[model samples]
Target: MDESDGEALAAREWRLIREERWPGPMNMALDEIAAETAAAGGPRTLRVYRWEPSTLSLGYRQDPDTVDWGYCAAEGITVTRRQTGGGGIYHDSHGDISYTIAAPADELPGDLVESYRRLCTPILDAFDRLDVPAAFAETGRPALHDPACYLRELHPAHDVVVPGDDGPRKVSGNAQHRRTDAVVQHGSLTYAVRPERHLAAFADPSVDAATFRERVTGIEDHADVTRTAAVSTVEEALAEWADAAEGSWTEDELARARERANEKYGSDAWTRRRPGDR
Candidate 1:
């Protein structure tokens, strides 16, 4: 690496947080907290986490009516809203591997696409490390307007896909939420696609498992690695990319995250409200 590259890598103390299981609301809350903390000069953080009880996270502007509330409730799936925009994602604890990267906005590329590429570098590396060839879609696809993220159109810059018999199928869906002081990008990596549960979360009746399977794919489908190994590989790739040191959440941070969870992410006012309502 060049002198400038070394200085850039050392600019912030990167903290690597391994997998932690939490309820849906708390996971979202923690991402917000991490961004705020980084803006306030805390360590830049890269974290891998899982959603307990399998939650359905709606996009910031996504209509709650798109969700099948009755089915979600009966199936014991938690519903929460993400700070970022995109379609809803059914994060199965066993099938989904989620991650987040938070840093001061000024430290990264100002252009949105450029920033996504910079942050997603590690993710692409992780897929390669697992012997699953993956890359960003070379061209954008027409939007399907499906309520589920994986079923939506692919973006050339951020949506990571793996080779398939038909074509490149999306294996990961990523989105960013930029604040005045910091940026947080969180994404879902499909370790194993659960078609039934994924389709059941949406209210649309016409979409079925076959439609979902055609568009979305999983890492396990192309690679022999187990979910646990895949998570570890991703964590390692992120840590190396950031040159991060092992870390854990502080007590005060957790307390603050819990408060935010209850007031925002976990509340019906936030989850059920229509876009532009607040």
Candidate 2:
């Protein structure tokens, strides 16, 4: 083969992992595995997953105490923390889709914000293909110490949003955690609004639920887009953008995720971190 053809063949192709809905701990464990695996020269990946029984995920440095424990206990909501930084998100198995892209850091841009923007090309393309008219947030002003991820003013550069008459309602929220030689970027692509109280009850017991729902948008809100369609759209986008080949996980990656679950994700010592508590 010619040198150029050889280079083309050597280009990294994505391994697709369409994981079934799992617990918050295992979900996060898999993400960590994505990062480490990519750093170790594993194949690039596009992973899709969901949360079962509904779960609430907090930012890396966020205070777990910000959540109203009584509310969660009464409602049976699973509380966990993400490896990436951001506000807390309520992962509804029946309501949303979660996706992540893992590749060598060198494959991505060096700038933090730009890297975030670029990694989303496939998602943006997917939305465009679906005629959803979604784009990145134009302004990413920080939230006023709010624990609710949806409550934060959409970080224009960091999030994907759908424009509407009411405002720019965020459709997806993304964050990044860089490994030595790899990068893992994950986000939630919701299709419908959660029960306002599901998020409000824990984020702030006093906030009205209906108002919170207005701050965000779901794929279903426009064009009645189904999760299945959204997933397919994204998969199409990935294939078009990267020429990625579909594949599955290696035994080593699964083992790493399992080990991470035992030591980090599954442990309250890691998830339940608060200001003074640990």
- Who wins the lDDT comparison? 1
RMSD versus native structure for model 2: 3.6
> Candidate 2's residue-wise lDDT over 94-132, tens digit each?
777888888888877789988876778778877788788
| TM-score of candidate 1 against the unseen true structure | 0.96
* Overall lDDT per candidate, in order of appearance: 0.91, 0.76
The TM-score between candidate 2 and the true structure equals 0.89
lDDT score for residue 276 of model 1: 89
TM-score for each model: 0.96, 0.89
lDDT of 2: 0.76
> Which window of 10 residues has the lowest lDDT sum in candidate 2?
1-10
lDDT agreement of model 1 with the native = 0.91
